[model samples]
Structures are given as C-alpha cells and as structure tokens.
Target: MKLFFILFFLLVLSVVPAYSYLDPGAGSMLAQLIMGGVAGLVVLFKLYWGKFKSLFVKTDSTTPEKDNSSQTE
Candidate 1:
C-alpha cells in the first residue's frame, strides 16, 4: 500500500511538465479543450456510472418473491 501510494504520487508528479512547453495557440488550445472535455467525461462517467448501470439492469420482477419460504416457523 505504501509503495502504491508512492508510485501514484510519483506518477502524478511526473505529469506536471507534460504540457509545460505547449504553446497557447489556437491548435494547442483546441487540443487542450478536447483533452479536458474527455477528462471531464471520464470523471462524469465515474460519478454516475452506478446510476447509469442501474438504468440498464434487468430486474427479476416476473417471479414473485418467496415471502413465506423462510419467515414461517
């Protein structure tokens, strides 16, 4: 766990200069915008993935639940 944390921190730190020399021209700005949009989509998906998945899940409602199978003494 400690090693994982250290590696994660190092990976995060290593991305600091990824765009340090990128020019702020139109092309670069557009590229950054697209990257940011993709990142935003990824984060949004992570945030709502559970709800999204539940939307597609098939609930087994056809079979009535057995209420007296276990509760009866």
Candidate 2:
C-alpha cells in the first residue's frame, strides 16, 4: 500500500498543467448547477422535515404510564 501510494503520488506530480480557457457560458452553467443542487436540497428538506422531527419525538401511546402514586406516599 505504501509503495502504491508513492507511485501514485509520483504519477500525479509528473503531469503537465494544461492551459485552458473557460467561456462565460461555462461559468453560468456551473453556477446554475450549484444553485439547482441547493434548491433541490431545500425542497427535499422541506418535504421530509416533519418525518425528521418525528424521529426524535415519542408520540406513541402503547407504553404503560409510570407509577407516580408511590412517590407521593
């Protein structure tokens, strides 16, 4: 594993940098993709917010009530 990582590191370091131009349309598309992801996450959370809250809240009535009368006695 160490040898593999060393080889991989050397391989990555040997790569030449590429000079590329990013057009305005590419930037706009990237921004739209990020915003779309954020919007989708917000909508998803809104839809599941109630279910998420229910995970921590105990609403079931099946459990028996604790005996509090003995405490008073």
Candidate 3:
C-alpha cells in the first residue's frame, strides 16, 4: 500500500502542461444559473414558510391540559 501511494503521488506530481480559455458568455451564463437557483429557493421558502414553521412549533391541541383550563367545567 505504501509503494502504491508513493507511486501515485509521484505520478500526480510529474505532469503539468495546459492552458485553458473561458469565454465571457460562459461566465455570464454560469452567474445567471446560480442567481436563478437562489431566487427559486427564496420563492419556495416563501411559499412553504408556514409549513416549515409548523415543524418546529408545538400546537396547543397536542397537549390537551392547556386548553382544558379555558373551557367551562
């Protein structure tokens, strides 16, 4: 295992040669996609905020003793 790891490390370190080019249009498209995803998440949360809040909240009916005091006996 040590020999294999050493060889792999050497192999990874020995190679380096390549210039990459990115067009301006591609960068703008990537930015738009990121912004759109964030906007969609915001809209989704707004639509489901009530349901999300309910997950962490305890309703009075779940524990009947609290409401029992309010009723006439």
Q: How should the candidates be ordered by lDDT, best one leading?
A: 3, 2, 1
Measured on C-alpha atoms, candidate 2 has an lDDT of: 0.50
Off by over 4 Å in 1: 16-73
Give the lDDT of residue 26 in candidate 2. 54
Please tell me which model should have the higher TM-score, number 1 or number 2. Answer: 2
What digit string (tens of lDDT, one per residue) describes model 2 on residues 1-73? 6545634664575464543233336546644543567564455445357556867998763343335433433
Clashing pairs in 1: none
Query: Candidate 3: lDDT over CA atoms?
Result: 0.50
TM-score for candidate 2:
0.23
lDDT, candidate 2, residue 67?
A: 51
Judged by whole-model lDDT over C-alpha atoms, candidate 1 comes out at: 0.48
Candidate 2 local lDDT, residue 57: 92
Clashing pairs in 3: none
lDDT of candidate 1 over 1-73, digit per residue (tens)? 6545634654574443332222337445544543566564455345357556756997663343345334432
The TM-score values for the models, in the order shown, are 0.21, 0.23, 0.23
The worst-scoring run of ten residues by lDDT in candidate 3 lies at 15-24
